[model samples]
Target chain A: MNRYPEIADRLMGLDEAVSRFVKDGCQLAIGGFTITRNPMAVAYEIVRQRVKDIHLVCHSNGQALDVLVGAGCVRRLEIAYGGNGRYAPTCVRFKKAVQRSEIEFEDYSNYQMSLRFLAGALSIPFIPTKSGLGSDLMNYEGFPPDIRREKKVASKKYAKMQNPFSEQRDEVVLLPALTPDVTILHAQFVGDDGTVRMKGLTFADIEQAKAADAVIVTCEDIVPRSFIRTDPDQNSLPPFFVDAIVKVPYGAHPTACYGFYDYDPKHLNLYRKMAEDDALFREYLDEWVYGVSSWEDYLTKVGMEMILKIKANPVIGYAPGLDRK
Target chain B: MIQYSDNEMMALAAGRFIKDGDIVFAGTGVSILAATAAKRIFAPKAVIFFETGGIDPSLDEIPMAVADLRAMAGTSLNSGLIEAFSIVGHRKLHTVAFLGAAQIDRYGNLNTTCIGDYFKPRTRFSGSGGACDVATFASGVITFMQHEKRRFVEKLDYLTSVGWYKGGNSRKELGLRRGGALAVVTNLGVLRFHEETKEMYLAEYFPGVTIGKIVESTGFPIDTSMAVEADAPTPGELQILREEVDPQRLICQAVLAAPQK
Candidate 1:
């Protein structure tokens, strides 16, 4: 019944997938909105492998971006929303790095960045938008204007042109396409043929998959193509778009996966504290990163009880104790 | 008279501005509370749109962020950021917005990008997510922030989102299509913009609030000739807000600690 038997058995280990696709000085786009379903397991592997000078890209970034910045694995950031949620104070490392001129920063709003992905996915040169016309984010040199002129070029990607259709004085801004060298995404399920099914809030996942040169998918379960074909409405990304598939359960741990778990606030709080200081950050790396061999070992370090405690209560979509009733 | 917290009063003031069938573009936090209050009290047919691409969601609880899963699932339309801005936001007319600002000027210009300077900011916030787009496209925009001397500045340290730039005809010069920011709701009072000048002036003061406190708190001088005392929250509005809208009391918890004390 299926025609894609050649693409079967695409499942592989996390570290092996990271090593095979990611490299130094490569541009990497990560998919997730804030602290939900980010490819944190593969991100940790990138840190462990000492992949330096990598350019980071995401529309809505949170702990994962902060972790990579804290680990010194990033040299450039193409960002839109880089703030933490209400639970934490701020992303301290990202702020410090930007202030210290350690990282090249290019800023975009949520709409602007999404249009960039849409353009890339459509194979268009650029897309027209009315979002960033008057804001300072349109500068050709990028944010922190005097810091790194040569290294920051994303702001130069925009151009202003007259809207020919409008008789009135109107000008539309064009945002250039963004296609990264490699992209990483975490999902609830993926088929052996590399079809990705995200449970909730597919924020730029499909666009990034179609736009990137290579896409590495980390999923909780690798099911047969037949399972994915049953309820095809939830089938977000098709197999032709994905390059590799890695099966890693609890892949979005610390961050929540809808219908699977709730975010570990205590762990995020601990990370927020440790990420502020360099020595503590290194110690955190030792205890969490190099201290483990594989994803299974990482879960063991996190403890089974804690994992079970954060499991989703099917009725409310979060853990039971949070109901407060 | 019913006793109501300042956060509830602020929500009431914002909710009163919504019509029955208005389309509102809501941000996180206070905006959600205000819009929810509106839906329960008067504007039953009011449609709420989140920038995360959710249109008319069936919300059970306050979402943590605009991109929360609850914002997407079971919505009338579940699109992405592109459709939010391009197809629905920009193309449509008569859309309302609920905005937040770290600082605001007399012209209603907002600052959420940073403070001091763009290069070396004294304090930096997570830059505007969809605030700029909303400020640019929406027909009517309302800003909500804690009223304080530092926040009501004469000039913003950096203008992230434009309200009525330089007071008059500036938005038109920029080719933007919308009636700029119309009102700013604070814990102390309500401020409305002048029709021609576009300058914000004190329109009403909440219960137990004094005119002197508002005048001292504002960084710039304002017109108070048309000022009126605001009515206390009605029992029906308070009951719905407490029992159904914010039963968890997230907004109440924030405003209970200190309210013009």
Candidate 2:
């Protein structure tokens, strides 16, 4: 008898997972920060499946966010920051898309976005914070009034009211909670029983996963039950929270995964170059996304030598002295 | 005479502002360099953390981004974004954030969002990641900039992060209890806000940079009465910053120029 019968049933291929759960006009929350642990394999598969009109919600995303937006999979975006560190100060394709007014977009600070996810996770209607009190984030409503009536979109950008607890004129900004249709993340390990473990900084991944209706996790390694259970503290999420689990090694390639590898600077640099022009970006999609048969095939295109160079040291949790430039 | 880059000077100048027991919140680019320099050279006891929730990391290598794996390496504890923000505004802690922006106003309000209109920006930058949060919560903020007239604008295209708001007690009147812009560190000099008016005034011009050059470069009216010539970067400070803080010269590498007599 399979110890993890429920997880066994949920285990599916990346293509199957994307087709079944991700649909047109679904709200999405992607895990990871600027240069680490982005769910790239699923992002690529979404592109391959030509998933469209995704309303992406993010805090400070990088590789996967850029790829989805670049490949024209995203229709609406609510983001705090879109950057890839030193590689690209502002994500090239994201910058172009916003500058060209290709997608409906709104902005929030990282804390505000994180709080929104937290509020969603807690099943709250709205969350109050002092973060965007005096900035344009409070003034400008990026989404049009008509779009506000949509299912996932908030009714208003933000609402301000005086603090009820304080007799003095203490005011705060109230942000609407975000409950995305799905949240996807890449992790270092997922047990056969479906327990997930992510090393390094979790960013807002936990809150995002809890906030979503469905959660998809793609991981580098799927370990045995005994190993994952030995240290409960190390595990990130409970098995029941994860709706689908796909084991794809280097699932976050070109983005760092703590003890797994460093971000592939060479690839990121190439992407930066290719994403600069419209014609070249299409070629990048053809050669990289559409051209590849599978994740393994994609890795083969990335090659063995670069893999070895980017591999992280277990003790330090990153490839020290990697040629980041 | 020792020749130093502008980055080297800026890092040292900003690092000096940090003291022991302060919590330093660092952004990427020169801010990282300055934060590291502060810990290594100025304040060994100061704890360096990232917005991604890496508390007191060893920082064996310079992180290219706030979420770089290097930031998580050898950390005392590795948490996530919510926890990190908790520490930033913890009331008890004295958090000093270092940030860079595309444009800044006379009151130190920042624009990291977009140029032109918000709807169709001519130049779009990475929108305020955590700058707004830190600027609101941290005990103070030290901003980095390139001293150019266009960058030091009278009015920002968009204010992504609130500094002094409209100056004076405006930030306080806007409902922020504590934090405000502490100083502005640039390629040419250091600027501080007035105690009463809250307007930016030239506090220190670098050894070679003239007061007139600073005045010419600023887009808005600035007070020069309080301006004084800043001390040159010492050999010891330069050695530590170049050798230990950033051996890769990732952010510290800039065109070397001789200090004017």
Candidate 3:
């Protein structure tokens, strides 16, 4: 019906998705950060799905977000807080993009992103709060010089500030309403009618659903209406809020789906390795997410036996979670 | 036999600077490894607040990326992933690890912000999150970065956190508290500073990495080893570093080869 195929078709076709999202100019806002992060799948799906002009906003400074930015899906980013682990560094792609002046970057604290979502959910123009007041992140798109080099330092301004009415010292950072063209969310269960349910803190998902004009929900398994009706309170997003719903198991293969499945370190390492080599990244996605006909087909090529083998081998020093593998 | 690399060795040096009963912030690389190694070696009682990963008593290899936080929480020693988040994001703990950058100055400042110019220059890197807060109030901050010339610039394009811009004692002159790079361990050597001027002097050396190489690469001047008596990693420290500190030796896995048969 549209220039691209249906939403479900777009999600499974790796290179197609990447071209659409990473290169095309589609303004998209993703959900979740590190722990409960659902965006990686959507990110990979974008690379797999090929939706374009992607814009990401979240509370984490991790690699999934970096992947989208790195793939060049991001023309501009609106984020509150973001970082990879400490030793690795932050937004390597963003830094390089900034160096090259390749993209426009609008940074806010994660709280600001959260507030934006809350404002959207609450139906407001912008939340009138100051969260990043005195911190140095206010003026510059990035940050000030390393305080280490200074013989003495000047005072700083933050990106967000806190409320005087409350006793908190942390910033209240104001977030303007973000109305993305579409929103993509990953969840545990989805019905044919587009209902989402989760076991943990859905964070600002409901707000995200309310803010966007179009929404797509991806899931590992699709439940019937009876299932969702049984535990309606547990449902994170209602059916009407979601425009499209696709069920793809192991959708969160590289990124964990939270309570549903433990993280796959092997897949993560593969992504890390892929990021180190652009050709490999494209090639791998081409062979995997896009090339395969379905989730079952992709898993078969990756080898379920290999996954089981990986499951048997505890990730060495990193402990084994609840054994979802 | 335990296998380690120069980077892991750097982690040990960074860990050594941590004292007992200190609060720490953590990220990945040597920051994560060094913090754990420090706990394994000394200051076992040192209080560490993981950045939302409940990593203080982490039992497994720390996932390097934030998404790994899910893996970490799912697997680490105690409570669920949510509990881990509480420890890092909200819980008030001490002495955590942080990643370092290319251009660290004489005063113990680090630059992970940008490359070209502040007004509008080259590249823009990931900026501060809790890094500013950790670097601001921690007992002391330890910086870890691979030592290289391309990285060590005269002035940082932008600063990620507040390091000792002046010297340790002089930080107050610029109006800062307990926030200076106390130790910076690189592949080439170990360095400490004048708590105020941030003036640096070589404290130790790595066998393969040379002083000349470091001198050529560093952005600032280093107190000559010949000019001063340098400290050495004791056998005990070395033994712990090779064995218990990183028994699995995850650091150089990024690029390691099978032992030459």
Candidate 4:
């Protein structure tokens, strides 16, 4: 009856998958850009389990990054940007953490971060780019000297070298590669065969997956092997790369998943209001994250009206005129 | 006589800089408005793209952020970050990027990272997302700012993106092949770089805005000898920006008090 018997062992619950791969102080990469397709369900589960001291590497993450940092689960971060689209220009928790010096942080441009992941996937030690040539990203190293010597941290923020092939004066910034201990992503569909398919804008998820030692994927639906195999072009990653697969509908809530739903403006607006103050943020975490028994319970709190309101029109890929204000 | 908001006039003024066949890299807020205005009104053939890898999206609805789902819908191609950067620095393409910053200097260098020490900041903004990359790789950059004494500083607290890079051949000496600050659009007017020295100079002051106000608002001395009064927004231009571009008034709602000459 099972179309793909090979991947039957990989299918597991959210708790087991996260507990198995994500551990204390491990280097992690989360896939998404700003406000789209964040692995929120898994991020919440990590918070519920109280996974501590995570070293997060990302390019331009939004809700997931904010939630994890806000929950006090992250200790060190290598990121490009920390802001939601329109909700919070600079993520409230992230800004507070940086200003308070609670966590060690470093900054890179999106291209530099992407190229680092690409280098890791290519099995190269480092990569070169023209970005951040004269910028302070090259001048200031946010990580302390001790942390630089620690495992999974780059020895230097950046290095400058003359182009070996060029006869004239030419320079490029060399960035160390990033091979995360585990990479987490949320997708529109994952086949029973373990092939992952993302609907719109992969946004370096493929690169992050390839550069990680392990990959955990949460998806909206689990399709049959026969259905997913009919169109291989749509597949984002092959079966061998994904170590864990969990089927969780509305997994990327508060973040847009193309063809499924738009970002929850009402919820994000509420989060923005609560995240401003320390006491209010804790209460928000208690009600939204800790108080909820399960993802289903969380959905109940989100309510059916809000769900229907944010539902995307399949053809358009977002809720048209959904009063995003 | 037509009355236009600051955002409407700013968008139209920046839109005029775009031309046919340009690859426009857009950030959020007024930058998105200007990109849409450029395509619909000024340069119909110009393409608008996002750093998140949505190339030439239909943009039927205005996107609040570069990663908004609307940016991916009806796009010519849906790729990822790497592919998008390839197009930005592509030798063949003429890419023009639009950005925003918290602080800027006489050389047009921008600071979007932090306001204080590197170890601990008084204020930490969303770090250089892709502004640094586009400034390094694109053919030119147009920045949007609020004209204020604090914002237009003589020296940046932190240089997150290189503009002219200490002026003249400094940017080129730093190994970047092309791209530098082209113009700065603000609530009061437009500022352009000196042809040779690369220092920012007042190029245009909006209608009802005085050059004296601009000089006073700037943190450093600025050259206003070449400045002229910018044309007021036309009735047709305002209509397109209001009715068609952003009917919801998501970004164009703020109506500043009329400027006194």
Model 4's CAPRI class is medium
Give me candidate 4's TM-score against the actual structure: 0.98
Q: Of the pair 3 and 4, which is ahead by DockQ?
A: 4
Question: How do the residues A109-184 of candidate 2 rate in per-residue lDDT, one tens digit apiece?
Answer: 9999999999999999999999998999888899999999999999998899999999999999999999999999
lDDT for each residue of candidate 3 in A186-253, tens digit (9 for 90 to 100): 77777544667754335456667678776766676777677778878677777677666556665655
Model 4 chain B poorest 10 in a row by lDDT: B252-261
User: Which segments of candidate 4 are over 4 A away from where they belong?
Assistant: A1-4, B254-261
Error of 4 at B205 (Å): 0.4
- Each model's C-alpha lDDT? 0.76, 0.91, 0.54, 0.91
Listed in order, each prediction's TM-score against the native is 0.91, 0.98, 0.68, 0.98
Better of 2 and 3 by TM-score: 2
Give the Å shift of residue B101 in candidate 3.
1.5
Candidate 1 vs candidate 2, lDDT winner: 2
> Candidate 3, after superposition: displacement of residue A231 in Å?
12
Tens digit of lDDT per residue, candidate 3, span B154-236?
Answer: 66555545566545455443333234566767767777765435677677776556677778877666676543323445667
Q: Judged by DockQ cut-offs, is candidate 1 incorrect, acceptable, medium or high?
A: acceptable
Question: Model 1 compared with the native: what TM-score?
Answer: 0.91
**lDDT (10s digit) by residue, model 4, range B203-234:** 99999999999999999999999999998988
lDDT tens string, model 4, A210-231? 9999999999999988899999
Please report, as a residue range, the 10-residue window in candidate 2 chain A with the lowest summed lDDT: A1-10
Q: What TM-score does chain B alone reach in each candidate, compared with the true chain B? A: 0.94, 0.96, 0.74, 0.96
